[model samples]
Target: MTILLSQEIDRTSYEPAYAQLVNILQASMATGVFKPGAQLPSEAQLCEHYKVSPMTVRRVINILLDRGLVTTAQGRGTFVKGVDIGEAVFHLSGLKEQIESTDRAQVQLLEARIVEAPERVARKLELSPVDWTIFVRRLLLQDGTPVSYHRAYLIYDPRRPIVEGELEVTSLEGLIHGNGQTDLQSGCLSIEAVTLKEEEAAILSMGQGDPAFLIDHTFYDFQDRPVSWGWFIWRADRLKLSATIGNRPPQDQQSAMKDSRRWTGEDHE
Candidate 1:
């Protein structure tokens, strides 16, 4: 596709020229003017097109590269690395349950295991360094098309038979809460826009640097104690998040309780 330069360059502005250039490039990507793998105009070409210095154009290219929106080869030209618009649909449920409810996707469990939690995982789950965790990893498919990757960490408890059973048959969180061991209260969650790694992209059937929604969440018990922590990656093009916000708290706080198994983060709240 040919790169078009329509707007006249504004000589005086608070924003730097490179910043403006980045914005234009990003807008082009969003509008599909420049599709993924499409080579961008050379720095010299951009300099002439935007009436900017070569240094300025180079800086703009650097910004895109840092954000994982573009790649450059020494002899080859720069290319678009797919655009991520931060679209994600999150719910107070595990990925399996969420996808199943959609009735559009069939989830496939790729792997599952019990392992020692890393320091970050240990801190999030409030488990001791020596404590173990049941790590559930899986791939989700929509009509047999891969869409997401999930990794869940639950505190190790040998007594819970739920861990030993098939996860497909039982909800891990439901089983944990049903045991009367923990009463889920509330949770904290966070979401951010990210570029998928090569392996992650492969799993999602997308290219590296494709847009993805990185969701990090933590579940808490009735006493406001952390129960589980998880990370999920969803394809941006396939989902969008929606929520109803109210200034006042719910009429019945007890009845407004959400699922205990789902991760809650500030982004979702």
Candidate 2:
């Protein structure tokens, strides 16, 4: 079980050895020492070398597994995952255009229909308990490979005509903007790591329990009226987001300040 690794675990530090092992392996991967498809040291090897337990080894492997950093074969061993572009931080805007600009990227409408608003959707839009809304589901692709699955529920006004064709060809974000009445003012967007469920995995062409990003967006209008929002699930290995960390433009800053004032007054948006 004993094997030599030049960079041994720091037993003195408070951080668990398993976590440290993850960092070491990540550094190794970044430095090309652990190339894609290369098998990592076995559990016993890690245990003996790090003076740790089998449980600790398992934790390390599981962390790597969930992050899509490594994969395993039934009786074989764990191998590093190969990824083209992975991991990103993004602002609320420009998400759709970013995906399309990638090579041969396209959007495919999976389902679009008018349906009664679920409680959660109603609460987000601040609608009555029993209300109607448009449900839109779509898939994003790169070179025909599924990258993300997006589902959205919007405030549906039955009086307005539904344009199916335009909805299919345009990004949901763009479509919402085109309405003109629904001005997306400001809200929250959060991204979290998630284990894909059976249905989500099937749609993303990945295995159940595979790693993915769950992005939740909640936005209001200029008048602070909650209108529509989207929840997007993205494959960890295929997608990355980027953000600019700077002050908003002057006009946007003014708008944001106004939004903040409006938030304290009424729970409209």
At residue 20, what lDDT does model 1 achieve? 78
Which runs in model 2 stand beyond 4 Å of their true positions?
A: 1-98, 159-182, 241-269
Using lDDT, give the best candidate's number: 2
- Which residue pairs show backbone clashes in model 2? 88-241, 89-241
TM-score per candidate, in order? 0.47, 0.48
What is the lDDT of every predicted structure here?
0.68, 0.70
Q: How well does model 1 score by local distance difference test?
A: 0.68
- Give the Å shift of residue 25 in candidate 2: 38
Per-residue C-alpha lDDT of model 2 across residues 6-26, encoded as one tens digit per residue? 788898899878889877777
Q: TM-score of the candidate numbered 1?
A: 0.47
